[model samples]
Target chain A: MIEFIPVLLVIFTGFSGIMINRNIVMKLISLDIMNTGMVCFFVLISKMSGSFPPIIHSLDEMNLDFVDPIPQAVIVTAIVIGFSTLSLSIALTAMVIERTKKVKVDDIEKKVGT
Target chain B: MFLVLNFVYLFILFLLVLLRRLENLQIFFFVSFMFFLPFMKNMDEIFEGIGGVHIVFDDTSRLFVLMNVLVFLGVSLKMRGKKKIRFPFVLTFITLNFLYASADLFNIYVLLELLSLETMILISSGGKVKQFWSSVKYMIFGSVGMNIYLLGVGMVYMQNGTFDLTKILRVSNVSLVLIFTGLLVRTGFFLYGMWLPSAHSSAESEISAILSGVIVKGGIFSILRILSFEPFSSITPWITKVSAISSFLAVIFAITSKSFKRMLANHTLSQLGFIMSNVETAPMYAFAHALFKSWLFILADELPSERFDEMGKRLNLFPWIFLILGSFSIIGIPGTIGYAAKSSLFKNTYNFERFFLILASIGTSVSFSKLISRRPKISGWGGIKENLHNLYFSILVIGGGVVLFEFRMKSFIQSFLLFIVGFLLHRMIGKNLKELRNPLERIEVNLFVISTLILGMILWLIS
Candidate 1:
């Protein structure tokens, strides 16, 4: 139960960080944090069954105590997607900053017509 | 076998693009080939048991896929000049195919991430500062929505040991709330669509059309797919409310905005509201919207500055005629597809929701009054001869509605009367209408996320 609290705390912390930040890079970091928290939550749930990795040495010897591999595989995929998304967004922000010389949302907001 | 065949269809397009430069003729042939592919598909087929994921090809997805291809053909016709956009445009087109076919929640997430990422690349491909900022906002919104969606997927998986959508039953309602809230952001509901007017209006017209017409439908399709199950059908009415609210708010914004493209983007939300409020008839409405909305965007691409004050006096002969036709179809004149689609959607709903939808329909006309009331200048300053291909949409909107669906005589007069009222109302308030401080003009992530949370909490209390 306490371990679950840390996951929830991390998730909400990132969520709040996203809601409060006006800087674009900070928002991106918050988004990454939230993503990491969700991934960790998935990992925690998959680990509830066992701490052992989802590895089976022999085809016939099936280890029942091993954690579910599917969710782990899913997180691995999620991590890859998250990484790509983060990098692309960072590159996009870098381009924006390079062009406008504005990093804060307020300064940027006045430039774009409402 | 079917999945492999689908990949093969896209792969051939990929090869054609990668092998050499593709001309307009090559693109036309590719569009026609993919357009014919859906007719060959086996209906109601399920491809399962390979993994825990559920994948199905039913009538709804099949029809959506066909409509997307038809829209693609229309878009590709206009996609002549920009050789760079055509590649991402085609790739995003293929991603949409996979998105529509996805039945599992995880597949939807992955595909949505991919679809929006490709769209981000397309939007910022102009390499302009403004486009980059808007695309970054799109990227941020996409990642946030997908992450929340992931949380819901995790919870669902935790409760029911599998990700197969068909197998998940008796799941808690919180999961539904999380899922709905997350997907609504992607779908551009009232709170989250604040990013839409900027993002949609900023992207190139072709990309805007795709974003507005088809891509957002990816999330709506997922919501409808999830709501199709028996245990979760209870949440349908709330979706109706949410979409109704979104359309109404969007209409309010569109009516006041002076920018031509921004108003059109807002109306995309309104029409999407029309689609979402009535799920049973969504496919037909989605198809109709994809055609005409893309039609308008393609025409918008030809114009210089997208301002309403200048639009009437500046448009050439080709765009003026199509603009009037698109507006008529959008306002649901008696013989157009908009009339048929709106009539059916309104018929299947009732009570306050029906009233809300009716108000939204009237609001649609009122917003479109800016376009409808414009008297075209006869002298063509510029000949828009390059866009002869848009004739396809013109023919469909003009005659397809009556032939495709039984033109309801009962509501014909009602819609006409609604249009008159809307027109008169616009005329009365038209002079006074000024651009309101649109909360959506800037990317307000803080406000959007806060409202989403509040909505989630309210939904939690309700459930």
Candidate 2:
């Protein structure tokens, strides 16, 4: 259970970073930080058992010495998903910035006034 | 077999999206219909593990998938002759086919993120600055919610060593609470629903219609899924009270809101609360809310502006027919699908919760009663065929009321009495409806989320 402490710390830091940023770009950066933290959190949970990567051609090659492979695969998938959403967020923020010409959400809200 | 059909559906949709020339509305409609046929064929039984061990199909998924397809068909028809939205509309439906059917907890997260991203695209696709702002608001909350959900998934994986929903070793309460909070933010729960009205009101009508109707239901499957785990049932009872409070409060917000579309948006929030309070019968309530609310939104766009003050003067080219049908359905009059769904929802609940839900319904009736009083101009009668979607859903709402098994004279009397009370309240409140205040309006989004998380934590620890 102590191995989970660092993972929880990384995630909590990322979450706080998200809440503190007022600029959309900063917020996106904070979101990326949080997602990266989560990705690492997923990967590190499996590493507590073994450091060796799980790569085997057949069932016979499987051994107790290898780390769990599922979380590793999921983290890669998570990274890809995180990348796509981040890029989409950047593109959307660009559109908003182009219109409002302001980076802070508070400033933009004042100008847009909707 | 279901997997193959989904692949085929994806193939056609991809081609449609990639080749702009092939993006005609009819082809999109044809593809959605072709994919829906199999679901209709297999509606009677659950197809467990059809394609993979991780994927599970059951009655809840079936109802949601049906709503997704049918509402898409209706909404796409409503967008006919409109330019510039063809691409995003096709793209939105592309990922939705997989969102409900997949049973893995993590898979649902990715699909939900994709669905929300696509919806943001669609909402921003309206090409207005206000629309951009609204979608931006949604993206902020949505991103935060899903990240928290991912963290919760990690916590679940830490305990269970697996992501499969059907097989769980153990799930801690805090993790489940985190997951539930993430979904609730998107599902438009009471304090968390601030993003909903703005997002729903600012988008183009058809887009708002679809978002309000069912796309936000990304949470329903997981909510129901988590509720089934016996160890985690501690949080179950609080779900009802939370949803009921949101339902009644949202109706209060709707009754006072001055903007026409925003009022409709608030009602969607309120109805979502109603739908959430009784998850056993949620699909029926959801289906009812989906059809009629979308119809109201489509008709609302026909008005000149969202101002209530101007609306009282004249409604030129307004389709009063659809409004009347939708209002009757919304207010839960005796012969509409809303009545049927609400009655069934009420019958299964205790007297106290039912009374509170009825109070919410009374507020809904009061909110909509004002709309029915407004008189539209002569042009409303002439252009009935132009709105094929209205005609389509109109039949469903009224027809569904007739066929639903929950019909009872007691239910009818309660609903009728509520309708009368709403009208009297509307009359007393009169024209100063705009002067009413929304108490939750002043709460900051970030603060609201933190407090809600704390609240969920406290709920879990106590329960």
Candidate 3:
């Protein structure tokens, strides 16, 4: 659906950021954005199947359609995993900076002589 | 009950992380084995895995768990006085646990990424420039492989509407080529894993042990999972042939490699190819190789350079027990663990495939011969404590292999003659063999493309 276009755009932008950016931190941020965009895309697709959250309530006997909960569960797990990945990436980046004291990928490469 | 135990172990790991106590990492691994014990209560649960929930304890997985626990205990004992080892060590352990527990395709991907990230961190921690470049190369290759796999997943999801391998296994041929190719890339088939030697061998010895031992095994696990559950009915012939051809070429390449660690890395690739060729036997062989090879890499890494001369001197003093046991296990010597897997493979594969296995085994023996020939000479001054620890770890691994072989004695015995023949052939050619120039030189663009094409064509023909 057209509603998914923005998510797609975000994902595209993330990919481009990674490709074009020479700074390692910028590239890592792009990876984060790409992961977030993926989670959003999954959520948006799940939303297409229903109009409301999947939570059940005993007080309401009315017909309250609910979206598929599977993708939502998967996305939540993915998000947690993404956070761990982000932390690890930042840790690695810090290590790199500590050693080379440069955040630019090209500069590090030059310093290390390929 | 098994699920609860798994959750409990994970919770314990979480607490260890929160407390920031690194020694608890070994305790956590020990607890994981304790957890696995209850799961083994119902023998039926052994076969039941993550997705398929099948009724068998996958002999291979059991072996891997045992090996992992044993080596980890040995390493942990040697790890005293090392500060700030908690985070990286615990993270790696958690990732390995997750990898072992995962059943679904996407779960494997997530775990693999975690493993890779942890590996990069561990490698770069040494502050070596070469290590950084190798890690960068590893990341690039890994990302490219992951993206290709993601595209395949997209195609699979579109076709089958599910990512659960159990469900995917029920469907056939809809996206077979895509699935296989994706998995091939992920498993480091042929030239695709060119970065493996650099990344795996360049790291510190302990890091190398984990990378070569656990990380690459994760890829092999996924490949085995796909082969086992997926509807390979349509592509069996093609898969079999391609596996045979690729595995043969890998063995040849491994035989030609030098540098102790680099040769071992190539051997990992070649051995993986051999395991993949006999799909029926792959699950167990893959599991056993991961267990044994990981330990071997650790042992090889821990060989003290300072005591190299002492080790060489005392090498003959200690009974040839460890070397004989370890070599026999790897070369499928009779009454060793490798024989059990080899027998199963030979029994299931066709004559042509059997011939390939024979040649591959010979290549392995030849490569390892090169390894043994370069053993560092030991001096008399090496400390008793360090030597004792080394002896204990080496014996433990060798003993584990022996126990595995005994457990599968009948199958192992059947492969005895084949192994002896292979070993003799290796001894003959290995002695006369001249070392090639560093295989790194062949990584040039033109040679890379040519090799890839040649390998691909051979695969096509064999398939």
Candidate 4:
């Protein structure tokens, strides 16, 4: 439970970073931070149940204590989605900087008045 | 066997992407394949287990699949001569088809992520800097929304120990609110949908048609599925209240918007209010709205992007004629598809919600009437190809009217009266309208996401 405090703190920091920053790249980084925090939270919460890996190669292992496997699997998928989102967002940020020469959102808005 | 069909379709689409030759034949084959899908219906395995494709042959899925096929067919018409467009276009359709059939929670989440990613790719394909920015904003907001969804998924899994929607018996109020919040954020219900007008309006008409027509409704459908759970049915009344407020605000915004495309985009959001308030009629309204909204977007895409006051003048006969029909379809005139769908709501809903929805519909007609310009005395014949395109869409709209002629005579007269009142209202304030800026700016969307999640959590705790 104590470890959960830092994870919540990190999530809050990432969230405020996204809300307060004006630069697109900064926002992308903040989003990554938030995703990492969520992944960490999922993994941490799953540990409350058991300490061993979820594998059961033998009947004895089946009776032995094991951590939940579902959240671990979900975390893997979430991490992959997070990576794709980060890379694509970075690519878009590069394109934005290429055309407008400014990473600040207001400057870009001024350039293209959308 | 049902799941295998999806893999086979993906393989074919991949082969099409690789072998770009004979593109016309390939498109014809794919369109025919899609249209042929609805007839091979089986009622046996409506509820499949986790880690497998889940589909049903119920009324909503039927309507959902039909709209998906129709939009794909319409968009394919504009794909000729475009570079690298067919790949994502077909990819998005495939993802949406699977999404409509998914019954499990995790399956829906994964499919939704795929849909979002593919749509972002499609939007950025336009090669304009504005399109890139809009796509980027879309990605940012979309990822944030999904993260919130994941958080809810975590809570549900922690509480219920499974991600199978049918297997879970009950959920705490906290997780339910978190889940609904995630769905609402994606649907762009109310203030959270600031990214919609810019993203939908900036794309080419075909792309915009799909975005406005089907993709937005994807979020609403997810919510409908969630609310149908017996434990969560209690939330329906609250959702109806929220939707009424959203409908009214969105209509006001649409009525005041300066650009025709933006006005139509807001109208899309406003219609979500109507569909969400009544669960029984949601699917029907969604089906009709998809047809008429896409028809309208396709027609509006042909007009120049100048203000309504400027471009409506000196219009050709093609746009003029279809524009009226498209508006009629959207306004639910007596003989249109919109009339059939709106009449369904009138039959089922009663009291304040019904009154508010009707007001919102009239506001929709009023706002659209502002875009209507008088026919020029001497109209020029436009490009033959474009006129043919208009004629094609007009036939579809008229066909919808003819096919959906089951509404009562009273429905026609009521809608006609509403249309006249809306037009008179439009004439009064048409000149005073001004441009409304995007309310959900980049930073603000992030704020709303977190605040909404927190609000849901607090509401859950209180309840």
Off by over 4 Å in 2: A56-64, B21-23, B41-53, B229-233, B316-318, B383-385, B434-444, B455-463
lDDT of 4 by residue, A1-114 (tens): 688789878877887787889888898899999999989889976886887998878887777667877778767887888898789878987998999899898899789767
Candidate 1: where is the Cα deviation over 4 Å? A58-64, B25-41, B312-315, B380-385, B440-463
| Local accuracy of candidate 1 as per-residue lDDT tens digits, A8-63 | 78887787777688898998898899889998999997987887777778876575
Of the true interface contacts, each candidate retains a share of 0.61, 0.41, 0.09, 0.57
TM-score, candidate 1, chain B alone: 0.93
What is candidate 2's lDDT per residue for B306-360, written digit by digit as tens? 6777765656544676788899998888778888888888888886567779899
Better of 3 and 4 by DockQ: 4
The TM-score each candidate achieves on chain A is 0.88, 0.84, 0.89, 0.91
Worst 10 residues of 1 chain A by lDDT: A105-114
- Which one wins by DockQ: 1 or 4? 1
Please give the CA lDDT of all the candidate structures.
Answer: 0.78, 0.76, 0.60, 0.76
- The regions of model 3 sitting more than 4 angstroms off are A1-69, A72-114, B17-28, B43-64, B159-161, B168-175, B230-242, B302-325, B373-463
What order do candidates take by lDDT, descending?
1, 4, 2, 3
Candidate 2 residue-wise lDDT at A109: 72
Residue B445 local lDDT, model 3 = 34
